[model samples]
Target: MTETAATNEQISATLVLPYLNHAVRMYEQKYASRADIDAAMRFGCGYPKGPLTVLDELGLDTVHDQLAARYAETGDNLHKPADLLTALVGEGRTGKSDGRGFYTYANGEVIADDETPSADDQPQLRHDIKKVGVVGTGTMASGIVQVFAQAGYDVVFVGRGEDKIAGVIGGITKGLDKLIEKGRSDEATKEAVLGRLTGATTREALADVDIVVEAIAEDLDLKLELFRDFDRIIKQGAILATTTSSLPITQLADATSRPESVIGMHFFNPATVMKLVEVVTAPATGADVNETTLALCAKVGKVAVSCADRSGFIVNALLFPYLNDACLLAESGVELSVIDDAIKAEAGFPMGPFQLLDVVGNDVSLAIQKELFAEFKEPGFAPAASLEKVVADGHLGRKTKKGFHDYS
Candidate 1:
């Protein structure tokens, strides 16, 4: 191999080690099935392959040894190879080379094995939710409103003012009009969806909806206050959910009178397009509530993966740390473009870490990194100084037209 190509491979392998370790940790914790975990990264983040699939290609034995060495060198628990990885290596499920690892392979490719339990295996969906009340009018909330309305549920969306509410409806209409122009939808479908939507300015209007989903900001105090209001105004058995990407769900659940009814339905940005929904269950969340939430995800045409109420749920928890590490790698004197190019070329990631950080906004990235660090107390999870410096300089990525790279 050329010197540059060999260097790219080395950087790619170093970058993937922590990410693969976290995937194994998530698996051992039963956050989601192997298939679902793979699907989440693929569908949610647009990864060419899931972490486990990449692990399989790398060989379980090789990764275990690398991780063991890294852990010994750094003395960080995050680098310690997961027990699952060790056990797999011990059993000789080395990787695709041996036709086994995190998955079975045949003819030099995965054999399409699915371990996700079918709906039939789950407890029967307990709630009958015909109406969904969404409390926000931002991009995420608007997308969620459109999703539920298109799925035939009456969606009551509340905003701070009539202008924000009008803006949301107008944006949805424009999107549908574009789809109509492209032959993907028609005027009739648009009208039908619009007819199911109700815009309001107050939380009291959501009193009768079967479920209320708040797609508001990530401020803990704001969300807690909203949950308290939801408890008082909403009907007895209606479910209360949050679309928080990082804050603990159990704390939000505790703010409500019916903690059992509060769960998390974390949808990715552009909720209308993304398919993965992390169905987070708090400690007090009932089994029926989780099943009902999973059923709701299916009804809305989303793939639901269950995870415990934690700092980052599944996707963000696994995603941000890798991004943070990339920042550290850059601090170690590697060019940002080089690291980005190497990861994209060698690992099939849709965006390199710096590119993704810019797109996500460095400020938001720093905040999420802080949440992960605070939750796990892992030294490796700390937000990189490079990321913090950019945010502090007000170069919050694409929005500010400057970050690690100048967008202007």
Candidate 2:
């Protein structure tokens, strides 16, 4: 397509139009709404327009027919028309030209009102996740506790001692306070979220919960012990989950007698902030448990993606390799500023790789990279020497007040 381009317009369209098609296909798959998909791409990747919005302006029928014909002729999966697109075309609602598409079009413009996919159309939930118990007092634990409480679920957060439990509550309060200051939440909402939180220092308190999520360290043995304990304490049909981002879900599930009830609910850091939650299912995990976990994710306002029980799941699996390469680039005497700036300006990434590493914690990044290397044994995937040194020097990132860029 770019072969004889005489101007930037042709090349830019050639690069962008395919992705715009992809975005439309993704909305059809129910990954997210046209508005959210667009918002995320615009804010997260710095795209000028969300793919679906572009498709809406360009016309959905044009994209659908092109993709459908290409798929039939070339047998390329990438060119396949989305089912939703096909249905819209069959119904003669092509796009802006005809006043209908992914968005309701009127006079060549769309109504600005946003819509959430109606929950009434959702799949039948297998089991309810009404109340949840979280075990730990760390940032992730407290973050997850806040996520549940904010979603109106009664949360019993377990910690070892009175002071530690107080600290966890204090952490949740401080986070909510920051949210309020930013106008992301309000005083009444904070009170209601806090009111839903109950503290416990033992597993005994989790006995009445519908689900228990362990948010402790990433050690396999410790997680095994916790799962075993949860198996013994929580009720017969309750679900068990781990927030381990890089560890193997199968190993944790095997530690419990009821492997079918065990699954992975890998919430991103500062659980209340990040939208993604990898809902992983081990081979032995029950269908009901998987469905319940996914339903709970929607209830708690997180976008969930199902994945197999594997190291790093999806996001970390793809993210760390790039971060590792950035470390190698910096260590090879390339100026970090040049790399960060060039990638941001040219690639349109919201944050350069080093900035992401700092936010993710070099220690955590290195840990995840090591997990990846151990599983895949790819020499390129090995942790960069610079990453190790930064971790060893105690400059983990924002949490430590220093990293690839100084935060202090």
The candidate that wins on lDDT is 1
TM-scores of the models, in the given order? 0.94, 0.71
**Which pairs, if any, clash in model 2?**
none
Residue 282 C-alpha lDDT in model 2: 92
Where is model 1 more than 4 Å wrong at Cα? 1-6, 69-76, 105-119, 122-124
Q: Which residue pairs in model 1 clash with each other?
A: none
Error of 2 at 261 (Å): 0.6
lDDT minimum window of 10 residues, candidate 1: 1-10
313 in model 2: Cα distance from truth in Å? 0.9
Model 1, span 1-408: residue lDDT tens: 223444787778667899999999999888777877888888789998899988998889989999999899878788899999999999999999999888888999677557535656764569989889999999999999999998999999999999998998998998889889999999999999999989999989999999999999889999999999999999989999999988888999999879999999999889999998888899999898998998889888988888888787778888999999888878877888999999999988999999999999999999999989998898899899999999999999999999888989
RMSD in Å for all candidates: 2.5, 7.7
Write down the lDDT of every candidate, Cα atoms only: 0.89, 0.76
Candidate 2 regions off by >4 Å? 1-121, 178-187
